[model samples]
Target: MGFSAEWLSLREPADRAARDGPLAQQAAKAAGPNPLVVDFGCGTGATWRALAPYLPTGARWRFVDNEPALLAEAGRVAGENAELVEADLGEMDALPLAGASLVTASALLDLMPEAWVADLARRLDVPFYATLNYDGRMSWAPAHDDDAAVTAAFNQHQQGDKGMGPALGPNSADRTIALFEAAGFMVLSADSTWLLGPDKAPLQRELTNGIAQAANEAGAREAASWGRHRHAIADRTTCHIGHIDILALPTGNLQESTHVLR
Candidate 1:
């Protein structure tokens, strides 16, 4: 199923907070002036919203997604500087990367398979910055007995086909890094983890329900009960979800940038 605009809206704040600033700056610097940035799987243009401030005003944006409704919503916010394209992300050959100074995606790579990701890496001649790739690590401040089971089941569900063969899921970041490195790109990476507290009850509630649904699908019998418990305590519970951001530049394109993790 495609992500709804409401869900993207709810998580946008957390996504903004969780992004790695230095990595974004590095990407912006590499892009230079008057660049064309192409975003894949662009959900309501959240990636653009997060990165726009750091990028040059002359930068133009191309947001691509399979869902026309989502593209429409993205276009509404991105205005004249943004061009929205409704296209299937499953078809990598059709990606609009021509004349792109930088290519980006947020919360996207984890849903694709290794072969697809590798093909994308090989196709990229410009700098690539991918953010918020799920790392499969999740935790709660007040842990429950069924947390491990629920988490395991949810992760299993994550690897299921997402219209791009078997998804890499949690392995996305590392695998993409290796593929880019092997393709002769210099890669830098950093943790972009979400630290959710009581103040983030809305997002935590949605996350709790979503995880429970995935767990139920994966045959976790306690999913319903776990969901109920988590949802009830959303006001007090703290959640930590791990994500990674990657900035890969073609070798000899930018030799002065150092690899640092923060």
Candidate 2:
């Protein structure tokens, strides 16, 4: 399904925090913020604000989003450092990241299948700071064991191909680490979770709906079960939690690479 402006507006803060916590920091320390950052599925430029502070002088934030509405908002949000690029990630050929110092996207990678992630990462073997992909279980307050059937069904729903080819589903969190490892990434560091509670958190809300919708779509049996499951856990509000993976991958052979490059 397509994303909503409300969704983007809601998750902006936590999204920004996730970006700041790990990937952005390492990138800034490793090579300075002047590096070219291409945000796949930029979505109103929420990720840009996080990347802004640590950024060195004259750094640029190139945002890519297929939706024109989002592009307008992203351009506005990105300010002087931002350059809005209107395009969809599925159209890999149309949107290339061969020269970018970093390729990043928040809550975007899991939406696509394994092949596409591989394709994009292959295009640019640079550091990628990807975060907020839902891992399919959310429990707040007292906390409890996650509903297995609901989790399984919901995961299938999340993986329900949103057209860019079959997505990696809730499992993408784990899959991403493996993907990066095989890609020759050195694996700098990571933030494995984004937990949300009754704090009325923005990203929490975005992910709550995602988990519920997935449960609803998985099938009637699961839909009915998760409905009660959610209600029963009212004592402790719960929703899917997302994780961030930060990497400092070398582009074009790190061993032979120089600090200064073309």
Candidate 3:
């Protein structure tokens, strides 16, 4: 299922804060001047907003997403330098990669199948910057006895098809990096974990509820009570949800290279 604009908006602040600044800057610098950056699953243009300031002046963007409503919302804020393309990302063969100097996506790779990611790596001759991929590490403060079980079920649910076939889930970042490296790209990645404190109570509560629902759907019947406990204490509890940001640049195509590191 496609994410709503409201959800995207709710998560934007954390995504912005958690992103690795130096890695993003490196991708921007590697893009050079007047680059045409194509963003897949753009989701109200958060990725563009996150990277625009670092990119050279005259940089343009193509925001691609399957949802028309989300694309329209992205267009509302993307202004003159951005173009909106409504297309299903599942069709890797028809992606709008022509004339693209850089490619980006946020919270997207973990939902894609391994084959799809490999295909994307083979087709991209430009630098690829992807962010906020889930890494399956989650912890809650004032831990509950059921926390581990609920989280395990949620992670399993994440592997179910989210639009593409079977997803890579927590393994997405490592798999994508390996694929890009095999295709001759130098990849750099950093932990971008969302460390939510009491100030982020709303997000923490919503995320806990989502996890509970996913866990229940994956057959963890006890997660309902676990969710209630977590939700009730959300305002006082802290959360650590692991995520990763990756920047992969094609060798020889870019002047700079960063060695792959965790």
Which pairs, if any, clash in model 2? Answer: 112-167, 138-239
Could you give candidate 3's per-residue lDDT for residues 1-262 as a string of tens digits?
Answer: 5998888888889989999998888889878787999999998999888999998876999999999999888888878888999998999877899999899999999989999999999998899999999999999888889988998999999989986788999889989989999999888898899989888888887899999999999999899999898889888998899999999888866655454565
TM-score attained by model 2? 0.81
lDDT of 2 by residue, 25-90 (tens): 666554444578888888777767766677777777788888888888888866777777787678
Looking at candidate 1, the ten consecutive residues that score lowest on lDDT are: 253-262
What C-alpha lDDT does candidate 2 achieve relative to the native structure? 0.65
Better candidate by TM-score, 1 or 2: 1
Worst 10 residues of 3 by lDDT: 253-262
TM-score of each: 0.96, 0.81, 0.96
All-Cα superposition RMSD per candidate = 1.4, 4.8, 1.3
Query: What is the lDDT, from 0 to 100, of the residue 196 in candidate 3?
Result: 90
Score residue 254 of candidate 3 by CA lDDT: 60
